[model samples]
Target: MTVVKFLRLPENVDLPLPSYATPGAAGMDLRACLPDGDVILDPGCIALVPTGFAVEIPSGTEMQIRPRSGLAVRHGLMIPNSPGTVDEDYRGSVKVALLNAGKEPFTIGHGDRIAQAVIAPILKPQIVEVDTLSETERGSGGFGSTGVKE
Candidate 1:
């Protein structure tokens, strides 16, 4: 298990730190830290909700903020940039940008689970320029070049 050190802002003392909902869960639930109560998000609108916590992510790893499955299926809420990355060098409060796609306005209350944080390993590969590349059967095929097959 990787160790992630966190700092809770003064205004977020009442809020719980992000945690895995289940023993086998791959990500931890990140909660909203609204200082002014509930926030209404209209259809096609986006809001950057603060998580009230700053993290010191270990080197060689990154924290990816992702949309929750339940919110997407039930409320049509999603992260504008899915899997938003928090690099190891960042030391600011973690936030999630949520977009409301549903017809009705969605209310985001304080301490509500808004997103999930997934810690993943990062790999930096050295770049090398090549004159020509090997070709495959589906070479130069873009988009639906490969038809759906069962």
Candidate 2:
């Protein structure tokens, strides 16, 4: 397994570190590190909730920030940029961009599990420009072209 180095901010030293919910979990839960009071996200509003920590990810890998399933289903809370990418080179505090999609306001308490991060390997593909390209069976099929079910 790859080892990741984490630096906890002074303000968040007392907060619990991110951990996997279960043995089979692919991602670790990230909590809100609000120094003040709870944050109220009004409907249709977006906010960047800080995690109050930084990480040193190994090269050729990235941390993907994903929304919590419970929050999305029960409270309509979602990560605006689902599977948000944290490049391996980034060493700044991790923050989650949360969006309130429900009609009612959502309150995010301190230390609440606001998001999850999945550390995964990434591949950089080389791009080649060509005058002609090959076509596929579903070439340029936009939107619902695939129908409701496969």
All candidates' TM-scores?
0.96, 0.96
Q: State how far residue 79 of model 1 sits from its true place (Å).
A: 0.8
- Candidate 1 residue pairs in backbone clash: none
Instruction: Report, for every candidate in turn, its global Cα lDDT versus the true structure.
Output: 0.94, 0.92
lDDT string for model 2 (21-117, tens) is 9999999999999988799999999999999899889999999999999999999999999999999999999999999999899999989999999
Candidate 1 ranges beyond 4 A from true positions: none
Weakest 10 consecutive residues of candidate 1 by summed lDDT: 9-18
lDDT (tens digit, per residue) of candidate 1 on 56-75: 98899999999999999899
Among all windows of 10 consecutive residues in model 2, the one with the lowest summed lDDT is 9-18
The TM-score, computed over Cα atoms with residue i paired to residue i, of candidate 1 is 0.96
